[model samples]
Target: MLATGHADLVSVFLGSGTLTVAGQSDVDRKATRFDPARTTVNVTDAALRPAPGSPAYDFLGVPAGTPIHVIPQTFQPGVLWAGWNTEAIPRGALAGDSVDITLNQARGPGLVEVYLTGLDGPERVWSSRNPGPRTLRTAVPTHAHANWAFTAPGVYELEFVASATAASGAPLVSAPVRYVIVVGPLAAAPTRTTLDVAETVGGLRLTGRVSGGPAHLDGGVPTGWMEFHRHYADRDDVVDHVAVDGGSAVLPVPDEPDALGYTARFVPAFHDLVAPSESPTVANPRAPPGAIVVGVRDRYTAGDTITATALVTPAQPDHTISWWTRKGSTTTPRGTTGVLTITATTDLDGAELGYDLIDTKGNAVASARAVPLRVSPAPPPTSTSPTTGPTVGPSTTTTSGPGAPPTTTTEPCVATEVTRTVRPGEVEVVTDGHFDYGPVIEGGTLTARVKDDRQGTPTWRDPSGYVFHLTDTARTTPPAGSGYDFLGSGPVWTIPLTQRPGIPWIGWNTQHPSVLGAVTGDVTMTLESVNGPGKLAVYGQDPFGGVGDRYFGTVEGFPRSTAIPAGRSGVHVHGVWAFTAPGSYSVTFAFTTTANGRPLTTKSTLAFHIGPGDPAAARPASTVVDQVGRTPSGQECALGTRGLADTGASGDVLFGLIVAATLLIPLGLLLTNVATLAAARRRR
Candidate 1:
């Protein structure tokens, strides 16, 4: 016999209840409250049940009421169900309308008893009465129906008889059902029930598993009447949906949020018997408040380390908790509450930490706060401190206190959408997760690409923290195509190919895609197998459009081979765009006569205009730089404005451009004298 009843109800916030899943959904969350492992009943044993005061607490640490069936009179004096009755029901059946009893079976029959108990207090009670012993004939010819019942509500106990005998009437133990009669205005309509959720560090799991004892009630246990739903206060995207598995519930650890919380929605909550509100407003807050306090014991300089105590507490200890540092969204906490020492590193521009609590039933509550994890600027080098008062000297150890170990909280780089401030001649970049740099550059296109073919396309990872772009020419519109172009993005596809077999270069020539990837392959070997043994192969794509199996050549500097032996590794190939005169250039790779398949070829890709490398050889003898921008010294950069430098020597200077000023005057004077002398001779 099992105990069945209701507990405190809970108000839920559905939108905030959603979570990110990295595993199976049918998984059960092991509750720390009661062990389901010990509840196994040996149906064959005459005496069966949990020993009194045993670790198993009334079906998951719950308080249940009355026995559903009992056996007062037994024919035999032998074995009973191998267990004791823990109910508070009366042992005898002399009761009137105030007591009720029942033994029901639509499909099968089991021995049962009915009785009652008196209350000691809200937490304790007493019962030792019976309605007499009776035998439940399981092997009887007509074992069709054994439905039993009694009249009224209080002063009675209910029990299920086991190992009952036909002769001498052996006796068994019993448990009482606690039934309180309601007569006040605040009394509920009997349809309302409290939903108290458990808080956890890992998250919640609500399976909608609805179970109750007295499985066969006056009209069979009302497992069907009960239903479960979610209430997401922050996530209002959807109103409701059907929960699964016998009203058993499952909630889980949510994914990192985009903001503080999701939109709100009111989904139906679950309950066996719905009780009315005691008060008109709302039930006693089923959930407790959560809090986290942060305080510093010492102040550390910028780029240094410091720490503070993180104290977290809740009204009741029903929820789980965890700590989290800021990322792009509100996330899980760092090892949930204790002392969290944060460092004063330069990366802590906008750091945050949060705590999450979960209930045994998988309900959750959370709280978080944001703070600046900034590094204090370093102290000035020289002490202006009254030199007159005392002789001053430079000291590196500037801080004083009871020395403590350094503390550092996680400090991530700016988020993907972050924008770094820029300078005229400098470009901005993210050095790491902790640094934003200002670097000087010339006219060079700096392109970058990052990939992890194994993990696939990831939204959480992007170049959000570092941004590089050119500044427009303040107010002057260009005469046309004279500036620069920036290309920054590419497709990072996550192709799960560990078990993927090599597809035919062309689909038609091969067998209908033989499933041989998991088999032995030349290079795709299995070194480990936690999840299906699979790996990513780093193979270069053919530059041409046609597909074919071909022999790719070896590195030019390495020993050449027509076909690589099994398990052979690949070598690196470096390419350069030559600065010689612009002409059609063709390069080739050789695998000797031993080469087997088709020639490894790629079409012409990279194309650009190339002028002279020397100033004198440049087609134009002179190109002027007038509105040249320069640093405060007005000195031209050695690399020049466009990263183009002027030839260093006289021979390298562009032709026809006058260099020495002394050689110019004589030539001008000679031309002027010739004109004057010609005019005088003509006049004579």
Candidate 2:
């Protein structure tokens, strides 16, 4: 597996009542959150060859002037800085408004210590040299950096957990999360692998060879199986494993029409002594051109001006470029240009900017995917004027008849929420990208979100991105005993339980990394509402056409919910989603789960263009706005003063710490998690 050669900065934040860890390097413009079990954080030899001799630094338990690896509390030019923050935990959300961080275990070659330099002196938070569990308590909305000291160069695994009492009188605790830190020089020798693919009469043949280090003490060739991964539109799937024979492996796979690309990785038998290697992606004949690139800003505020541009590989100057806006099967042509410039208004929020490459005949040959826009509200105005006089507030009084209780009307708080819309061509056409609901830590709140998983990478997309076009291929009559009487004995458009050509394969997978790692209970996705030309129903069926789990339906007296088993890594489910008539269907769904002892629920509206009707005319289930935050509660009620500049979570210190996929998803991406794939190839 790949080790984080140099994480210039690492931030551990409170996510969904759990510790969310992320790291950034000089080479990485944005910090990325990774699964500690699957990643290794590397502390290079540049840390500290000679430890600080100051008496104040002696608490590190290492001899002064001796060799030590130190991730400093303050930023150093070439070394990494590890820190913690509680900014994602809102004020008054926890009992006593504080969170407890505990270092449950620290295993390393030598002593391991973490401390902070306070105004009084050095305050030690963790010391493996000492005995009991070391814990630190900090108020919510806190962010601080600390010094990490290691006595010897080796691999260290630090286990951490966060705990608190929720304001609702429940105990909240995080799962034990592990962080692997490798203090270099590394012990293992690296290796490399190369792959080649050829077409045979039977199918496609793959050959791979491993070389580099004679990683064994006996100078023996590496012996292990080679794992082959199939690349789809957005993710990679393991297809086959071939054991190495004479340092090389060959595997033959049946020719599949939809196959896009292939990649291979070498798994060393002496895994600990020799690092595994991976081969670059080998594109198939059907693989789309990778040279179509798009560029745009990450985010914008309302009323701000922005520009989005696209670049073609061969410089298609003669090709006509047309800009378009898409929302639920509706496409609005803007103009013909390679670049689009416009004012970012609130209405444009959640919308997308895209370009179509049209041939001389006016037919679109290639299209750049729609990139979603994130537009936040402008900062509230500053109040610094001196008041001429103290303003008096008006007193309210309630009056009612003597026999009746006071009759009063209380105005319910109305918070605006947003769930963006997406039409055809907005997202690349894909056969599979497991869809599910997972927790997302954003804006200081842990909220459930509809996520799209491409391989092991999970991304939170707006409801609009969940749209699917139900074409004639999905048209079929409901089978008897299918428990789908809601379709009224008429032909319906259905996304099948099995994969079919020219249509999307929609499914829910609770095994997504985020959901499987953080959640401890069953997840329920319920249909809250639906708006369309006709009714809708969702249910699972066996290959024999026997119906199984009935999830949701718009017909009266039909089930409207389905539950996924808790913490099960195999809960990948696909079902038939049937629609009664042709038109755009806006289906509202809510995913609920109890995580960290707190009950959480997130809602979103998915758009479905059923048949040949004008899908653009279909209205959304509910309106979406940007004057509101994307938190689970979507609460906008607030009255507060602007605080001084500090390293809060919202600042660059922690803001980039939240894990998210890039807004611009390249079409026909042929890539894999080479590091993860290598580790996964190890023999059992």
Candidate 3:
């Protein structure tokens, strides 16, 4: 039996979602092994780390359906998977059960099926891309001539063949295929798996592999899908989350769901997509046989409206959703912490809570997910008064109107993702060496702050720098600047036009720039040169507005025709004015190419600002008359009196002096007078 035996048992491993099958064939009858030079599989390059056709091939034991994931290297007919290799199963056969399946040298698309008859049902089966087109479905398959399967009793059989029967409208055909024994379960259960998670910008991605028991979640189970209403209440009311497309599932976490204090259980069975009047069979009463502990590690205060989200990417659409609350049997079977608000605010004191998230399609129960949330009291009021809290503040503690609950339109705080703003002078400019500018562009520097809302900076060159700055509410005027050619005498120069279509204009001998850059194209270079004593003036193509900076010109010479694209927005006009009453001035001739039958405008504002040595003589007589003025200082008023005559000859005054002197001299002789007076008294 051992000598006659051709098929045998091998190693077995577990996988989460898909399967693979590979083979080779030969036309030579004597060759023992199939030649890959002629054989074509869905893949080309072998396995990663271990190259194909080497000792690494046998050591790694490459199974079918594993994705060949490598960068740059081409993997034709992309299957989108990242890995390439599958696990194994075994069958009982005498000794040499090593049977090698034969495949063709060229690659062909086909269908694959795998089945284990006894213990349960088929393990996995799959097909290629959409069916090829027959003038109808370009996405449909073109060839379906082969079919394959794997069955090795206690061992597994893997088949890979292009079948003719797998066509959409085609009939089925018979072929020799094998099936593995399903009667006996594995001697030891596969190890359990765990999930590791982290928070990201908008969501979180959970990834990990199974450990003790292989990680498997089947939404295609025929029966026995759990529907949990409430544990310790009615098992019929409970329902499990479904896996719609493939093994991977997606769930959009609601922004307003309660957070913290929750657990999750994943029931491994199939359930209905539509709501059913009757409940399906429950494979495991405690569906999801596995448990994940969850709780809120973050908290918010009362009146705190929070927004949390989880972005899920599914192999396909149509996943399920369910919600949970805290109060429940088994404690672990709890749902979201309803005591906490969707925008949870703490009561008086700060506390932490969690929300129980449930997926309701296949067998996702309350025990499937956990969340951590913090319930913090609103920031304490600086005023310690009991009624000073935010909840009782002016914008809060409002009454509901007409059977409606009050709405909250405010949130606590979050970081804004705005780019920092630079000043206007930061506009990009040419630098000597080092790179300097906003990080948006590399190796470039800015000289002025940009108008950030997107208006680009205007450019200018010498001799044509008729730059425009807003003069008032409606007009723009020029200041002392560089856009002018040397003119022996004329009025201040205005912008020039290369061409002005629809309107005839005069041409001056020196008007056309002798050395303006090569004509951009066939252009009508408009020259606004004053003649017969006037200084600056001419007609242009600009209509209803000033010529913009995009100076347009044509290469064709005069009497030549050029196709003017279209538009009047660019500079294509000419103007002139005398400087008051000038001695010398300039004449600017702007260039413009035909624009929509008008003129194309380039900012090359060629102008003649030069004037005579004294332009004061150029002022109009009326302007000079307006300057007439009176003297700056007013006449002063004088106050004076006629001189008075001196009374030097006052006789009364001289006589009085003479008499007093005589009297005083006698008085000085008063002692003599007193002696005389005493003698006169004695005589009396």
- Which candidate has the top score in lDDT? 2
Q: For every candidate structure, what is the RMSD over all alpha carbons to the true structure, in angstroms?
A: 41.3, 32.1, 44.4
Candidate 1 regions with alpha-carbon error over 4 angstroms: 1-128, 136-139, 142-151, 154-252, 255-684
lDDT of candidate 3 over 357-449, digit per residue (tens): 345446544333334445666676685211000000000111111122322322211111112222222212110001100000001210111
lDDT of 3: 0.20
Q: Write the per-residue lDDT of candidate 2 for residues 447-524, one digit (tens) a residue.
A: 444444333222334444444566675677765544556677788887654333345545554433334434566778
Q: Which model is ahead, 2 or 3, in terms of lDDT?
A: 2
Better of 1 and 2 by lDDT: 2
| lDDT (Cα, 0-100) at 434 in candidate 2 | 35
Q: What is the lDDT for 397 in model 3?
A: 18
lDDT of each: 0.20, 0.54, 0.20
**Residue 166 C-alpha lDDT in model 2:** 81
Candidate 1 lDDT at 395 equals: 10
Assess every candidate by TM-score: 0.15, 0.32, 0.15
Instruction: State candidate 1's TM-score.
Output: 0.15
Q: Per-prediction count of colliding residue pairs? A: 127, 1, 153
